[model samples]
Target: MPSDSALPQEDLAVRLRDGDADALAAVYERHSRLVHTLALRALGNHHDAEDVTQQVFVAAWRGRHNLDPGQGPLAAWLVGITRHAVADLLAQRARTVRNLHAVAAQPAEPATASLDGAVTDRVVVAHALASLGEPRATILKLAFAEEQTHEEIARRLDLPLGTVKSHIRRGLLQLRENIRGVRADAS
Candidate 1:
């Protein structure tokens, strides 16, 4: 009997279908370089080409029973499988790139959470200021929010300088107490 390599292509394919490991080895030896070269050309990287080469042979071995030796050449069928394997690798690489871009495009989650917390704090402070009521709220808004000097606030509100200063100092203390209470309740 001829060695596996010495057998004609159709006989080898038949032997491969019959579960002859030697025939598969012989086939790999005969055409693996062709598959590897094709993969390298398509993928443009050595590591990826080597991986695709391994995948092609493994897939071919698993699907060996499907080979129709009389219909065509084994080399052609293997090349067809190589094309599919290269395409799969390319698609996998594309998906990885897309996932990386998606992650990069998103704002950092902690920063977003912190911004929301800051906005909430400002809202809470505003509500607390509103709760102050009367001349105190109006005086504080002019002194702090409107960024007026004590003299400017006194002049704007038509109050004495000492009265304006007193209202501002008392309003600040009340706001600090209100914020502390709110925070304590939240915790």
Candidate 2:
């Protein structure tokens, strides 16, 4: 019997679509290097390319039921998924860069004459964040300071996706109320 690794790409695609996990593995073995190289070239970073390659395989496995053997080679489909993953990662990077630049370009003062106003606000916010305690504070820091997506935070913290999101929402509201208290105190 021919191993799946030796099967034709179309056969492998069919096998994968029919829920053969081994076929997915075979598909990875057959075209992984091609996927990695293309991702590396487009992303221009070996690490990111590797990440995208992994993402491509994972996505392929999950979306296998949609696989049509007639839609050209499986390699083409993998490449399409790779393109989307790379584009998404690139867009995220661009957004982060723009946000950092906007923050950097902001005037130092907090629209107040006092030199320490901005510092005070930062300290207050930091304290407020810290007051959330434990996982809530850590989650918010990961979400805002580190600019991690909820999925990333969920994976890193080993929390449920919905739980991570809830923490962020509640944390933000608490921070807002904290700031309101600060403003009232200052006045």
Candidate 3:
């Protein structure tokens, strides 16, 4: 296989599907920052945004195999997930704020520390990426950082369309594994 940095999405996906841990690492390295930014912009704070970003990637890994490469690139899909998670987080915050404000005399719950913990959870996601190895990591970067479509990646790397699809599917599985590994280490 080519160096993770040099391989295209399809190739990375294939490696990921085959259970290459390196692929997952590449994905995280490439896209985690973008996801974090998207989450932050929507949630309006470093912590909530960070939490949402981690959630977005976790959700993506869970549904990676089912993703259709032709529908769009991974970054677009991740952005969609970030949007949904952010909306959910905002709604939850709004509800909490409204309920607290409604009782003007009642003492508010001590949630400041908890919210900070939420932010920490997101930063941990990068640590999780460390367990993964190559192509998946690289491919993910290509999809998110570069926002390259399968066709574009194919043209850039001179690979077949089928290859690109394989990289994404496999890459997702590798990501799932990496997340699991992160949890295990945490426990």
Candidate 4:
């Protein structure tokens, strides 16, 4: 049997079946930043995001036994957890808004500030990039952070030229979608 270090998460799950705190810690370390970013985007408040991040990991750890190796990478599972946690925060916020609006004498027009929620939007973008697995994540970071060309990315990752282009295109699309959603929610 290979050591946990030598095996993928599927095998790690087996080693953790009976209960290994280390496995849970490793998973948290690997994916927590991604989860935190997702939560921050959803909630738009750092304090709330931090609390929700803890909840997301707790849920994942408690449900670790149900993980399916064939389905996907553990990161995807964590992303799902992050999404749900954010949704929960959104729902709660909506409830509070509804309650507050009911008592307000005059509803202020929703602020149409030009720079509305830009910070939160950036945090969301940072989180989304962090969530992406390596090669994809590394490719994106290089493409965006350094304004590297597709050829440069290929050279850095030693991947095929086509693969580099595909990654950048796909990553940009995803980032656009994610940022749009975050902005919409923030407003």
Candidate 5:
């Protein structure tokens, strides 16, 4: 039997369009390394790159019906998906950073003593967020600053619901520790 790699691109495209998991696997085998390299170069981190690579293939498979064998090679189509995924990752990272800064630097109310205390608390929370990194920082910002529900955060971030929840839980714990330390140091 001919290996999947030997099969014509048109045949593979048709197989993929028909929802053949094997064809998707073959397509992934042929192009996943390219996707990973592109993601890694764009994201500059191994975990995010790997996540984008998986997301690229999953997005391609989910949208297989739209794949046109006549337009171009499957690899090119996958590359396009990878580009979108990378763009999304970067955009999300930027938004997370912005939210963290906003939360950290938010002005306190006009009340004198309360304003000082509120500003100090925001600063502590922001410091903790900056230390959490990536999705964790992002998740916490969405949950706390934006007051988004866990499901809303997961949907917006394209993360699993459980992952979003876990990040929020851990972030809150870390934030508490950091705040405690900050208070201890002040005293």
Candidate 6:
């Protein structure tokens, strides 16, 4: 009997349908390059293309019983599957972008939750600010609570202007993460 690679495409498709693992390997070796190339062309990123290539083969193996040799070439069916995989990846990327944008579009106020008569929200924000530690917590308090300018804070803290600015930046980020975590848990 011929090796899997030596068999005709239709015979390989049939063998693959019958659950022959060697046929799956043979199918991959013949078509992976084509799949990867198509994916790369559509995605324009080598890493994403490689991921889509792997997704195609995995999907192909999982759906092997669906192959119908009489309909067309196995290569063509693989091409169709590749197109679908690429579309799914692109859609996922779009959703991620939209989610990121939604997060960014939130109100610029430091804490919307603070505007209410809720001491709980104020306590949460204070706890988040305190958790920042040392110069960061102090820097944030001096900047926001005292309404001091960055230059004023630098002069008062005896730190470099840049160091004061760095502390404030990092402190705000950590506080945001902490507060967001609290909000998520509350909801």
Could you give candidate 1's per-residue lDDT for residues 1-187 as a string of tens digits?
Answer: 9988799899998888788999999998888999999999999987678778888988989998888998799899999999999998788668757866986898864754677798888998998899888799999998778899877887888976656756776787798789988999999
In candidate 6, list every pair of residues with a backbone clash.
none
Task: For each candidate, give its TM-score against the true structure.
Answer: 0.58, 0.68, 0.50, 0.50, 0.62, 0.62
Model 1 clash number: 0
In order, the Cα lDDT scores of the candidates are: 0.86, 0.86, 0.68, 0.74, 0.85, 0.87
Clashes of each: 0, 0, 18, 0, 0, 0
Comparing 1 and 3 on TM-score, the stronger one:
1
* 10 residues in a row with least lDDT, candidate 3: 125-134
Tell me the spans in candidate 2 whose CA falls farther than 4 Å from its real position: 110-123, 131-187
Candidate 4, residue 3: lDDT: 47
Model 3: how far residue 68 lies from native, Å: 1.3
Candidate 2 global CA lDDT score: 0.86
| Winner by TM-score | 2
Which whole-number lDDT from 0 to 100 does residue 76 have in model 4? Answer: 86
Q: Tens digit of lDDT per residue, candidate 5, span 25-135? A: 998888889999999998898767888898998899899999989899888898999999999878877876786798789886566667768777778888978988898
**In candidate 3, how many clashes are counted?**
18
Candidate 4 C-alpha error for residue 112, in Å: 38
Query: Per-residue alpha-carbon lDDT of model 2 for 33-64, expressed as tens digits?
Result: 99999989998977678778888998999999
lDDT (tens digit, per residue) of candidate 4 on 24-131: 776776678888888888678776777788888788778877877668877788888888888876786686577557747567546784464666556788988876
Candidate 3 C-alpha lDDT tens digits along 47-145: 566667777767777767765655666567678878888888777668657855775667755666697666666666555444445555565557656
Score residue 79 of candidate 4 by CA lDDT.
89
